[model samples]
Target: MSMSGEDDGPADSGLAPEGVTNDLVELLFFAYRDFVGDPDRMLAEYGFGRAHHRVLHFVYHYPGLTIAELLDILRITKQSLNRVLKDLIEQGHIVQKTGRSDRRQRLLYCSETGATLTAELTRVQVRRVARAIADPVADEPKGARDEHGFAAAQGFLMAMIEPEERAAVRSLMARRARSRR
Candidate 1:
């Protein structure tokens, strides 16, 4: 809102001046709220939080993720991550191995216990996503679906990232995808 009591967006900014973006912004917030609600509760039972879930999910997906790379991917300070990393390591949910070529590098991997927990958390979320994407109703979003009704959700998420980081994210995901195959 401007000082003139109007809700117009900034001058010279090509954004919707009539505040049309607020609806999507609010929806994103609400969607995220419900999306993480279950996981948040599950983590709390283990005395954990979103930080643990994020680290667990990434390390599970990207085995051999280094401390520095995880830091960059999470955009978190070492001090913040240290607490979570230490807890995860101490709980036997994650393990750090010396990088094969670079002995000084600490590569992260999830333990079997961590994998089980991650699977449970992911199962809950995947069910929610599947329900939302299954074209269940007449008013459901269809454009988000690609040909054969898949893959484009990933594209939409990739498009939402910062332009400069998109390439790096793509590279990271590509490496993970290859490993899975």
Candidate 2:
């Protein structure tokens, strides 16, 4: 509802109706926290953290991704990355190959063990997602229409993000989609 004392014109154009934004923000936070919960537990069992899970997930998706690419995708400092990479490499979960084009460059690949673990993590996540979508108790409509609506909302959210950020996000999503096939 518009404020009675205020002349609401372009001032409110960029803002979501008062309570809506807060409610959506809260929902997003809780949803993401729950989304990561299972994986965090699994990672903890393997002596890994979210950072390690992220590195493993991407390397498993894009085998032979360069360190520079991983750094860009992660947006973390080299020191932090190095610590995680060292642990992963020592655990025999990932292998670093000398770049063919640049011998000084290190390219990361998930080892067979890493691939297996990654697959397990992904399976767990997908199963959880499928269950959430399929649950009748959730009051969500059952079928393709519901899935399509979810996809549409995802696209809308992506569109609201900055273009350059979108490009990286799209690349990552496309890579994952292709890998799943």
Candidate 3:
């Protein structure tokens, strides 16, 4: 049978075969899993999960994120975030300070212990990324960049995120700026 529309068949269009998106989806899942493998094992040893890692990572990046801001960054409910923050604070990995102007507002900062933990976690992630780029099995093919394959994949990933989530992320960034003072 002859196809009348682009979506009806891949043979008459530029798009990949019907199942091509699945190939990309699976690749992303496995690739991300392997990407975080080293860090995941290390965090497990410390009784931390990915949620803890994400909190530590962003806190380390922003330096003075508030509870509201952290909630946005993690896309988690306030209650869930409080659980993680409480553990971190009790472990001496993070310190919360009351805002100078708005004493009711609490600002979160990493303690010396927190800084060390963040450093160790970052190293694990960096090494994993470096190894992936250097591995014979996973290294970019000879012409990957020239063919724009890597850029396309990155763009696709960004495009997949919902608009609302992006707005929340931007709001968190604004909170970080306001807290800097």
Could you tell me how far off, in angstroms, the CA of residue 74 lies in candidate 2 after the best superposition? Answer: 0.7
Local lDDT at 113 for model 3: 84
Could you tell me which residue pairs clash in candidate 2? none
What overall lDDT goes with each candidate model?
0.72, 0.70, 0.67
List, residue by residue over 84-141, the lDDT tens digit for candidate 1.
Answer: 9999999999999999999999999999999999989989887766665552322224
Task: Give the least accurate 10-residue stretch of model 3, judged by summed lDDT.
Answer: 154-163
Off by over 4 Å in 1: 1-20, 136-181
Q: Which residue pairs does candidate 3 place in steric collision?
A: none
Model 3 / residue 115 / CA error / Å: 0.9
Q: For each predicted model, how many residue pairs clash, with residues at least 3 apart or on different chains?
A: 0, 0, 0
Candidate 1 lDDT at 52 equals 97
RMSD of 2: 13.1
lDDT of 3 by residue, 1-181 (tens): 5475547364655454434344356446555665566567878988988788888888887887888888887889998988888888899988889988888888888899888989898987776555544432322234443242543553333233332343553354456546656
Question: How many angstroms is residue 126 displaced in model 3 relative to the true structure, after the best TM-score fit?
Answer: 2.1
